[model samples]
Target: MAHMSILLLVISSLLLASTNAHDFIKYGYNGANGADKWGSLSSDFSLCSQGKQQSPININKNTTNYDSNLKQAPRNYVLTKATLINNGINIVLKYDQGAGNLTLDGKIYALTQMIWHSPSEHTIDGQSFPVELQLIHRSSDNHIAVVAILYQYGSPDAFLLQIQDELEQLAKDKCTDEQEARVPVGVVQTRALERRTRKFFRYVGSLTAPPCTEDVAWIILGKVREMTKAQAASLKAPLSAEYQSNARPAQPINGRTVQLYDELHNVKKAPSSKSD
Candidate 1:
């Protein structure tokens, strides 16, 4: 019965994605058509305001409960040639089908795409990261799982640097079209997932973006990836002044329980795949 429910949810997500912007309206983080006005923007975005489980929420560790039943699933991501695009709002890297799969709760969800949000939409104890990477995956039946990895200021992050090099090119050219780039998805992604804590905060939430549908499975990693300030600035440079910070404000948890998995200890950081 549970499996059937997940399958049905996935079908709904696909249909929603197809007709999400049926009328073609612009929605953003701020201004006249900002987050606050999303529900009013159009009938399609009503969930952005009405949904009870919106994402990019603040994870208050103090109030969370540890759950040993949560599995530490492995993510087998393949290295692929992805198309990187500056959508004028955020930098998005779109991968081809069969590039990767994340096994969670005994089910495998195929990796779809990844997007960058500066100053992270989600916060920990009210603390925000310099940048956040959201890896999206979808099960064969339509259930969506989002893994949120936070990057802090420290040494340069190899994975980010690789993409950072291309960011400038796209920003300078102001290119709206996708630029082909070979990304080491396997090395970069796996390393991020195999964190020292082997821990994450899991909950049900809506998509951070509009058409904010609910029922998404969110897993936010506890470990923070390090990247130098210059690297962070390079990423934000692509956006216009107003969009320099694309992160949405942390939403309310809405009395939802956030399950934590922190049993795996002494986890070591993986070597950087900088050269790839």
Candidate 2:
């Protein structure tokens, strides 16, 4: 009986650990599991509160130093098989076998996924936009680099319009809590999403969410793109109410240098601040 009891206790412990591993503790944008309480929620997330190099920072134009050597990373994206997944919190378009590769700092990172945040995350000179698109890439060594584009309400975004049907279908599907709803979006050409700008802001920062891992290279386009109100609404429609306004507030710069790369050498005119 004693041996059986010990075995049962070990099994229970293992089961508890397995459950925790599969179902990660919930973290969100507001309330109990809000950004403020993320670090304390789990040991893995301690960096969320403690990391000095966190992301989605305000890029102050006046303070940014221009680096002429900084050239825009070449985005060699092509039409590829993709899936639109509503991961309960946000809509993620994941590319299977990668859409393309970005050559940054002598390392080639494969474009794996894209995530959208409403009301923007990073701001330019303290001005916010209506939407932000983040193209996430990973290198052969598992390093992360994100290219971000901010958008204001105006002309409909071509990329978003391309996937409008998929977005609507995903939104219509009832995804159980914590379960992802995925829809195959067929071959998608991501080159249209690329902005025609030589100017961008570069910085090293952490992931904006919990488990805020640092050392991520961020390249935010200096030009603000345009998207229609309906296009923005379609993105938010899939997310739950809490995650609809799903952008983390901008983090402090913390003395980290924000570099500006402008092919035209024109830093006097700031990036556009047009809003809806």
Candidate 3:
């Protein structure tokens, strides 16, 4: 009995240490665990430093190749039940039964979640915007694709305005001791958030966050959308202080081809200077 008790104690200690190690592993947008240190944070995140093809690259209009063969993927988004949650890192809206799917390259990738980043991640001619909305989709084979929309401050976004109340409530809940800050946002119409543009930039890249998984299909809208300053603030209010400005710096293109898909087949002139 004594030997058995000692063996159990040893096993328990090892289990606790394993759990504690996992809990200690954390990443953030600033300070010690910032983007710069992400590569060394864990073995899983080594791709963040070593991957040849990463995301959020500045779309240099002059250098991008115009692919007439490329076309806008069909977006079939519908109203669906969603839950907004402050995932301790960023705000995410998870769909219960998936909002819809985007048909691209002969595959259907289901829209599963949406996330936001302030001060935008991807840049156009090296110019950043006030906000960025990312719609995440996954194919049946577990392939990932992201459609990113950049937003400039202007008239309020109707979709965001509809969820303003829930956002504020989430912000309030985050300040408490509640481990899970999630609210049922009822049925959300994703179509209302769609931008009316056929032009987009496409490339193969990695996930923006840790683990930094590569092979993600990125579709960045060529046209920048508009949203009110207040709406942008509401999106950031629920996140912790460190995450308020959560955007990883643009990664190197590393010889990857960026294809611009436009029906008109005209490349927009690159701005000489950065503007809002």
TM-score, one value per model: 0.82, 0.87, 0.86
Residue 186 of model 1 has an lDDT of: 28
In model 2, which regions exceed 4 Å deviation? 1-23, 266-276
Clashing pairs in 1: 10-142
* Tens-digit lDDT track of model 3 for 13-63: 664333122233577778899988988998767888999998778999999
lDDT of 1 by residue, 1-276 (tens): 999999998986675574234224666777898888888987778888888999879899999988866767667787666666566677777775566888888889988788888999899999988899898898998888988889888988767665665666766756332332232332233344433345688999988877887899998987777889988888777767777788878887889999998754325433434211
The lDDT of model 3 is: 0.82
Minimal lDDT window, size 10, model 3: 15-24
Best-first order by TM-score: 2, 3, 1
Model 1 root-mean-square deviation: 7.4
Model 2 C-alpha lDDT per residue in residues 32-104, reported as the tens digit of each score:
9887888888877778798999988999999999987786687788889999988777788999886888889
Can you tell me which runs of candidate 3 are displaced by over 4 Å? 1-24, 175-178, 266-276
Candidate number of the best TM-score:
2
True-vs-predicted CA distance for residue 273, candidate 3, Å: 31
Best by lDDT: 2
